[model samples]
Structure formats: C-alpha cells, structure tokens
Target chain A: MRAAIRSEWTKLWTTRTVWWALLGAFVLMAAAAGQNAIYVENGDVTTASVAVMSVTIAQLAFVALAMLVMTGEYSAGTIRATLSWIPSRGRLLSAKIAVVSAVTLVTGVAVGLLGGVIASAIVDDSGSIAGDAFKIGIYLVLLGALATGLGAALRGPVVTLVVLLMTIVVIPPLLQLPDIAVLNGIADAFPGVAGGHFLYGDADPYPPLVGLLILAGWAALAVAAGWQVLTRRDA
Target chain B: MSITLEKLTKRYGPTLAVDGLDLAVRPGRVTGFLGPNGAGKSTTMRMVLGLDRPTSGRALVGGRAYDSYKWPLREMGALLEAKAVHPGRTGRNHLLAMARSNAVPDRRVDEVLAVVGLTDVARRRSGTHSLGMGQRLGIAGALLADPPVLMLDEPVNGLDPDGVRWIRGLLRDLAAEGRTVFVSSHLLSEMQMTADHLVVIGHGKLLADAPMTEIMGGHATLEDAYYELTGSAA
Candidate 1:
C-alpha cells in the first residue's frame, strides 16, 4: 500500500496536468474573491462567504485534475503497465484516492485562506476567517474523491466532465428553482448542494455534519462503483 | 523461473481470444511466441501479466499467479506494448514510477536507461520520442527490476535495424544469464535467430510447441515452418 501510494504521488506530479489545474484553480479563486469583495455590498457577505463562493468556480479545476488522474492512464494505454506493476486493483484505486485527496486538501486550504485574505483586504466589513478554510479543505477533498471515482468508472475526460457539470453545476440550479418539496429534497441530496450547505453554513434541511456526510456518502458510492468496474474489467 | 499456463481460456463476447492454452516456458532459453495477427499472442501475454483476467484456468509465473507475488515486478517484468506510457511524462519519470511501485531501487532507473542507451534523451517528454525511442523506453521499463521472468509483446514493432540488433543481443544476454525470456513477434526470421524454443498459435488454438530445431526440421526456413503450421491450422 505504501509503495502504491508512492507510485501514485510520482505519477500525479510527473505530468503537466496537475500543475496547470492547480494554477487555474488558484487564479480563478483569487479573481472571484477579489471581484466579489470589490463589487458586492459590504454588509451583504463576509470574507468567509466570499471565499466559499469563489471555491464553487475554482473547484471545477480541481475536479478536472482529479478526473484526469484516472482518465489519463486509460487514454495513454498506461493502465496496463500500471496494473502489471501493482496488480492489486483495490490497492491501486485506494492509493489514487489517497493521493488525490491529500493534494486537493492542501490546495483547497491554501486557496481558501489566500482568497479570504484578498477579500478581507478589499472589504472592511468582511468577517473573520474562522473555520471556513478547513471546511473548504474538507469539501474539496470529498469533491476530488468523487471526481476521481467518476473518472475511474467513466474512463473518459469529456464524459466525466459532462456528467459532473450536469450534476454539480447545471442540474442543481434547475432542481432548486422549482421550490417543490420533492425537488428541494432531491437538490439537497446532490453532492453539490450538500457541499454548499456544508461550506456556506446553511442548516435548513440538516446540520453541517449531515451535509458533509451526504457528500461523503456520494463519494463513497462513486468510489465503490469505480472499484467494481476496475476490478472486473480487463485493462 | 518459468511461466506455466494451465488450461487458460479467454472469451470476449463470443469471440474466443485464447482457447485452453497449456504450456510452460522455462528459464535459460528464449521462448518465441509466434502467431498471425489476431492469434491471441498479446492476449495470452496480457493474461500472464494479470492485465486481463483469464476466463478459465490460470497463468502462473514462477509457480504462482503474477499478482500473488508481493513484488510482481521484481519477480517478473513485462513490456506489453510499445509506448504504453503517458506521453506527457518524461521517460525517466515513467520508469521511476514503475520502479517505486515495486520497491525497486531508484538507481535502477538510471541503470536501465543507460543499458537501453537512452540516458541522454531520458529527460525529454516521451511524446516527443520517435517510435524506436519509445520501444527502447519500453524495454528499459521491462528491464528495470532485473526480474527473472521477462515477457515482451511485439517488442521489435517500431525499431530500426540497429535497435533490432541491440534487442536481439540484449535478449540473448538476458536469457544466457538464466532468466526466462518470452517474446512475441510476427517476424519468424527474427525469432529464428533469437529463440531456442517456439510456441505458435493460430485462431486462439495452439498450433505448434517445440524446440526451434525440431520445428525447423523438414522445412526450408523458419518462415516456411510458420506458414505451414499456421496455414494448416487456419
């Protein structure tokens, strides 16, 4: 397991995709936070809120990074070599999840804290940092896990990105617009909604803990399905 | 070390890729795996490497399944296909990752790169490499762990004459050191020069398995024997 993790770490950094994704995420986070701080009414939001909102856009870059972690191997035909080396499908998937989660956790915290500083510098009324950075870190880790699983299951960047966009970006807004009980419930159940509730501290339907658990559940389910496909299918 | 296939069978949705193959490839000699296109040479090697699950029976390396070994790469090394690498990564980094996966020493990466004469170009992105360079990189990977068992699929696919000659000498030297070498290629003349034993299949079925001299008997050349064997099987 340790060897597999080491190999995965090396694999992730040896390519240009991870660095580009990270740079893009940081840039997006900074721009969004700065814009929100400058343009929005000072009393309408806090520095933490600005950081949280900024992450919604920046998280896409991290999701793309996570998806590529698995999809890249499939596209390059390197998965066969990888399997021949490690041979244990479950261990390899676990190593990938661990590596992706660790990197995204650090990236999310860094981006969140940096964005908060940018917002607080621009807006006088912006609130304190508090636990928002840590929350964003956790959210991004689960989100990264979810994307990695989807990448493994889908095995294509475009398809995985489309499905993730539809669920996390497109479908959630439409689902929330109806305001019906079932529609609201379904929207709340989605990982994006649950993540938002957790990050933005919305406790309407459930506590922040429940929101985190809901997103975690989705990630676990996706990873389980990915493991199934990975183990059963021929490389 | 030896590769033992026991009743190994693989079927892909009504297409039989390999049908009940049973053979033991021993160490101290080069075993040539030959077949026409779609004859399951690659599929059989994939099964041995645990890339593809066998539909029935098993492929054993050194008396156990490939995955069962704690350090499979150290037990067996393989080049399943040319350029089976992430194009964005440097060839050196690719080999380093493979080395780390099986706990092989980091220095071995440099050693293999030097052995394959890729030391100077190892830092460049593999995407920028020519087909011959890519084949060399793949061979470097297969030799990274210095395993007792080595399996290569169509290893000479994209090599120039010099690269081909280098590989033939490398295979001979490796097998001379008592490592089990299993190489698959359609070039019978090349195999005739390198292999001590031969395993031929046609349409997923074993057509011939014998020593090179024995199979070459009563035929003008290795190519004639191969055509006669596969042609009759077809």
Candidate 2:
C-alpha cells in the first residue's frame, strides 16, 4: 500500500499537467469570484453561494486532472509497468483512492478556502457562512474521489469527462422536468444534486445527511466499476 | 526466476491474437520471442505479465502467476514497450518512481542509467528524448530492480547500431549472471546474434521453441528456420 501511494505521488508530482490543472483551478476560481463580487452589487446571490459558484467551474478542472491521472497511463501504455510493480489489483486501487482523495481534499479545501477568502474581501455582506462549513470541506473531497474513480473505470479522458459532466451538469438540469418530477426526484437524489446542498443552503431540496449518502453512493458505484474494469481488462 | 507459458490463448472478439501457444524460458539463457506484425507476440507477453487475461491456460513465473508474487519486481523486469516512462518526467525521475515501488535503492537509478549508457542524458525530460534514448531509458528502468527474469519487447526497435550492440552485450552479460532474459523482436537477423534460444510464433500460435543451434541445424540460419517454422516461404 505504501509503495502504491509512493508510485502515484511520484507520478503526480513529476507530471506538468497536475501543476497546470491545479493552477487553472485556482486562477479560474479566483477570477470568477473576483468578477462576481465586482459586478453584481445588488444581486440575489448570497456571499457564500457566490464564492461556492466559482467552485462549480473549477470543479471541471479538478475532474479533468483526476481523469488524466489514470488516462495518461493508458495513453502512454504505462499501465503494464504500474500493474507489474503492484500486482495485487485491489491494493493498487485502494492506495490510489486514498492518495488521490487526500491530495484532492487538500487542493479542494485550499481552493474553496481561498475563494471564500478572496470573495469575502470583495463583496460587502453582513451574512456569515453557514455553521456546517466542515461538511462543505468533506463534500469537496468526495467530489474529487468520485471523479477519480469514474476516470479510472472509463480509462479515457473524453469518456470520463463526458460522464462526469452529465452527472454534474446535464442530469441536474434534466431532473427539473415537470413531467418526470417523481423520477427527477430520484435522479435529484444523485450525488450532483445532493452535493449541491453543501453550497446552496436552505434552497437545497433534501437534507444534508441524505445528500451526502447520495454522493457517497455515486462514489461507491464508480469505485466498484473501476475495480471491475481494472481486474478484467488488458492493461 | 524461470518464465513459462503453457497453452496460452487470447481471443479478441472473433480475432485470435494468441492461439494456444506454449514456451519455456530457462535461467542463464537469452530467449527471443519472434513473430510477424500482428502475430500475437505482444499479446502473449502481456498475458505472461498478467497485463492481459488469457482466454485459456496460464503464463507463470517461478511456478506461480505474476499477481500471486508478493514482490514481482524482484522476480521479473520487463520493458514491454519503449516510452513506458511518462513523457512529462525526466529520465532519472522516471526510474526513481519505479524504483520506489519495488523498494529498490535510489542509487540503482544512477547505476542502471550508467549501465544503459544514458547517464549523460539522465536529467533530460523523457518527452524530449530520442526514440533510441527512450528505449535505453526503458532498458534502464527494467534493470533498476536487477530481477532474476527480464522480459523486453522490441528492445532494439528504434536503436542505432551502437545502441543495439550495447543492449545485445548487456543481455548476454545479464544472462551470464544466471538470469532469464526474454526478449521479443520481429527481426530474426537481430535475434540471430543476441538470442540463445528462439520461440517463433505466427498468426497467434507457437511454431518453434528450440536452441539456436538446433533450429539452425534444420535450415541455413535462424532466419531460414524462422521462415520454415512460421510456414512462410519468403
């Protein structure tokens, strides 16, 4: 497990893509938040929600970064080397999940915290951020792990990106259909909608704990699928 | 560690990439796996390394599957392809990452770089490496663990004559140390000078597995033996 973590950490640090994506995530979020604060003087957006909105755009970069971690190996044909070094398929995945989630959590928290700080400076608001700020932190970490698992299962950059975008962007809006409200209710019970509660406060459709479970279910499904693909397919 | 493939078969949908092939690789010998393009050599090697699941049968190292080994790097070192190193990393760092996985020393990174005559270019990013240099880096990576068994596919594919000669001598010396060196190449001429034993395959089936002398005894040279074994007149 230590070896797998080391391998992944080394790989992540050595690559230029990680830096580019991380920088992109940070800068884009900062810029978006800065713009929102400067432009929208009397808007309906809450200060906390405005700051978290930048995270939505930045989440795309995080998702891309996560997927590339696995897809890069497939493209370069290094998956064989990876498997050869850590033969136990389960340990490799577990270690990847642990390490990637930890890094993503750190990055996520930093990005969110930084955006919060920057947005707070620009916007003049008396409303305080919600008491359960820690839950938002956990949600950010879960989102990164969710992206990583889906990317590993798909093993292709485009495919994984499309799947994640569908869940995060497309499915949420589609679930708003009036005719499919019942089914939409179930689909809204998915991670994307559930996770939205972390940023949206009382405007969220469901309770926080149920929302977290929904997000967890998405991540668990992705990890299980990734495990199946990793074991059965040729590297 | 000795490498063995027993009736290994792989089917991709309707196409068969490896069809019931069998071969044995003994220690202290340089065994070459040879085949034409799309003849299942890479697929077979993937199976042996447990990168690909076989349709049937088994490929074993030291009487067990690759995944069964607690520390596989101590047993086998494979350069299944060149440019396995991530392009964004430096050559030294590429080996450093691989070395960490196997508990290999950091010094071995420099050692293998020197072994492959790549110390001069060690700090260069692998993305900027020439094809031959990338192959050398891959070889350096394979040697990092100093495993008893080595498997390389087309190790000399992009090499200059000097690089080819260097690798040929390295394979011979590694085998002399009583290690199993299994390599795959399409060129029989190259294998003629490097390999002690030949395993010929075509259209996903093993045609011959014999000593260089034994195969050559039935034909003019290893090339002729390869042609005869693969059932190709040209």
**So what's the TM-score on candidate 2?**
0.94
lDDT of each: 0.91, 0.81
Clashing pairs in 2: none
- The sequence of per-residue lDDT tens digits that candidate 2 reaches over residues B111-180 is 9898888999888888899999989988888788888999999999899999889889999999999999
Candidate 1 scores a C-alpha RMSD against the true structure in Å of: 1.5
**What is the C-alpha lDDT profile of model 2 across A1-235, one tens digit per residue?**
7877887788788879889988988898788767776654457554545556666677777777877777777887778888888877787778777766777777777777666677668777623433323445577668777877787799887888898899887877776766476876777676777887655653556776777877888888888888888988778
| Model 1 DockQ (Cα-based) | 0.87
Clashing residue pairs in candidate 1, if any?
A: none
lDDT of 1 at A125: 63
Number of the top TM-score candidate: 1
For all candidates, state DockQ relative to the true structure.
0.87, 0.73
- Model 2 scores what on Cα lDDT? 0.81
Which of the CAPRI classes, incorrect, acceptable, medium or high, describes model 1?
Answer: high
